[model samples]
Target: RYDVDAIHMDDYFYPYPIAGTPFPDDRSFSRYAASQGFSSTQRGDWRRNNVNLLIQQIKYTIAAEKPWVRFGVSPFGIYRNKRSTPDGSGSETNGLQNYDDLYADIKLWVEKGWVDYNLPQLYWEIGHKAADYTTLLHWWNANNFEQPLYIGQDLKRSVDKNELDVKIRQSREMSFVQGNCYWYGYLMLDNYREVYDHLRSQTHRAKALIPAYTHMHKGRPAKVKKLADVFTEDMHFLTWEHPKQPRNPETAQRFVVYRFRKGERVDISRAENIVKITPDNFFVLPYESGKSSYTYVVTALDAFHNESKPATIKVKL
Candidate 1:
C-alpha cells in the first residue's frame, strides 16, 4: 500500500548467547527439523538456514511486488574470526561474529545475491582491542562478494575519538567501499562535536545524488525537452518538459540542474556543479547582480537514478 525506495535490515538477527546457557530451542527444533531434513547435529546450520530463508523470501516477495525496491542488510562488523574458520576466510579480529554468535551467514547472503547491498557496522576505533575498525573495513572491502558495500559508522565513537574525518578519508581510499552510513541520526543533526559543521564544510561540501542502482536497471531515461527560461513579474524560472510520463523507469521522475559560468566548461559528472535535484520541472533562478550571463544544463533522472543526456540552455540577464 505504501511506496518505499528500499527495505533495510539491521544487525539484530539472533540474540547474543548468554554465558553457560544455551538457547532453549530444542523442542521447537525437534518438531520441524526432520520435516526440513535437518539432523540434530546440524542445529547451527539449521539456525543459519532459518535466517537465510527469511532473507530469500523477503527478496523474492519484493521482486514480485515491487521490482524497483532494493533489499539491503547491515550485519555485525565481524562475519567470522580467523580462529573460528579453518578456511581462513574470516577477519583477524577477536570479536563476536555474525556467523558464530548470531548465526547470520552475511557473506553467504551477499554471495548469493539475496541482499542488494551489505553494510557492516564497524563502530570500533581504528585500533580497537577486539575489533579494529580499519582491520574490519579492509576485510569487508576485500570480501564484498561483488556487491555494494557501505560502512556503518558509529557517530559518537568516531566523534569522541576525533577520528571521524580519518575514517571517511580511509573509506574513500578503498575502491570497493562505496559509502558510509552514520549511526544515530540525531547526534549528527544536533551537531555533536561539530560533526555537522565538519560534514558541510569538508566531507559533504556539495550536493550529491544517491548512487544509481545500475545493476538493477542500466537503461537511461529519455532526455528532457523544450528547455527554456520563464519570467514571472520579479522571479526568473528555468523550465523544461518531461520526456515521458513519470510512471516507469523509462520516464523522468526527477531532474538535475547544473549551472556554470559562461566561459567555464559544462561537466555534469562533478557533484560540485549540481545546483538542484528536484522532481519539479521548474526551478526558481536566484538572480545575481554582477552575473549577467550563465549557462545551465539539465538532465532527467529516472527512479533508479539512471541519468539522461544533457539539455543545455544559456540565459542572459
Candidate 2:
C-alpha cells in the first residue's frame, strides 16, 4: 500500500543518435509488425506507436487508481527543427528533434491530455547558437496544451547573474509557465556556486502552495469541524479536526495555517501571512510575544491543492 503522488518520465524514450550505429529494434519490430499491420519501412511509425501506447496506458492506470496523482514528462526541448519538419517544428534551431530523431511524439502526448505537465529540459543559456534557452522557453510556453509548464533549468550556466536574471524575468512574465526546477538535487543541497543563497533571498523568500491540477480534481475541500489552541511553557500549538472523507479526491490532504496581527487583514492567500502547511492537524507557532493577541485562520487543501474556506480562531496569550 504505497501512496504515490506523481509519476514522471524523462527524455530517454529513444536514445540520442550516434554517428552510424542503429538503435537495433529490428528483431522486435519484425516479430510484431506483421501482426500489427505495419510494413518494413514503417519501423519508425511502429516505434512511435509503441511509445505512445505506453504513455497513454500509464496515464489511464494512474487515473483509475488515484485520480489526483499526476503523470508528467520531461522531453528533449527541441521537438523538431523548422528546416526538417515545416508543419511540426516551431523553433529556429537545428538540434536533434525528439519527434524525428528520438521517435518521441511529446507534443501529441500533451495535446491529447495524456500527461498532466510538460517540463522541457531547456538547459542552454540565452545566446547559445544551437539550442537557445530563451527561444525554446517561449516556444513551449506558447504551445502548452493548457497544462502546467515547468522548465528544467541548468544550475551551472545560470550561476551568472545576467543569465539567471533573464530566466527569472521570463518565467515570471509568462502567465502559463508556473516555475522551473533544477536539473540535479545535490547541486541545490550543496549550494553549488551560492545558487541556493540567491534563490532563498530573492526568488524564494516566502513559501507558496503548489499550482493545482484543476482538470484532474476541482472544487474546495470541506471546512474543518473543530479548531482550538493550547499553550505550553514557552510554545504555542494550534490544533484542528476536519470531516472524514478519506477516499474522496476533494478531501483535505493537508491544512494551511495563517497568522495575522490583531488589527491586520486576515488574507489566507497572501504568502507572507502563511505560517505553515502541515499534514497533521496541529502546528507549532514561533514564540513571538507573550502579551499579544493573534488572529489565526486554517484552510484545507485537497489532493490537487484546491483550498477551502477558512476557519478562524482568535487567541490572546
Best-fitting candidate, measured by lDDT? 1
Clash number for each model: 0, 0
- Residue ranges of candidate 2 with Cα displaced over 4 Å: 160-162, 232-235, 244-247
Worst 10 residues of 2 by lDDT: 157-166
Evaluated against the true structure, the overall lDDT of model 2 is 0.86
Off by over 4 Å in 1: 243-247
Query: Per-residue lDDT of 23-52 in model 2, one digit per residue for the tens?
Result: 998889989998988998898888889889
Quote each prediction's TM-score: 0.96, 0.92
Cα RMSD to native, each candidate? Answer: 1.5, 2.0
Q: lDDT of all predictions, in order shown?
A: 0.89, 0.86
Per-residue alpha-carbon lDDT of model 1 for 1-317, expressed as tens digits? 77688999999888888899999998989999878989989888899999999999999998788777889998989999999999988899998999989999998988988898999999999989899999999999999875788999999999999999999999999988888999999998899988899889999999998788777788998888999999889899999998556447557888999998889999998999999999899999987784588899999988788899999999975
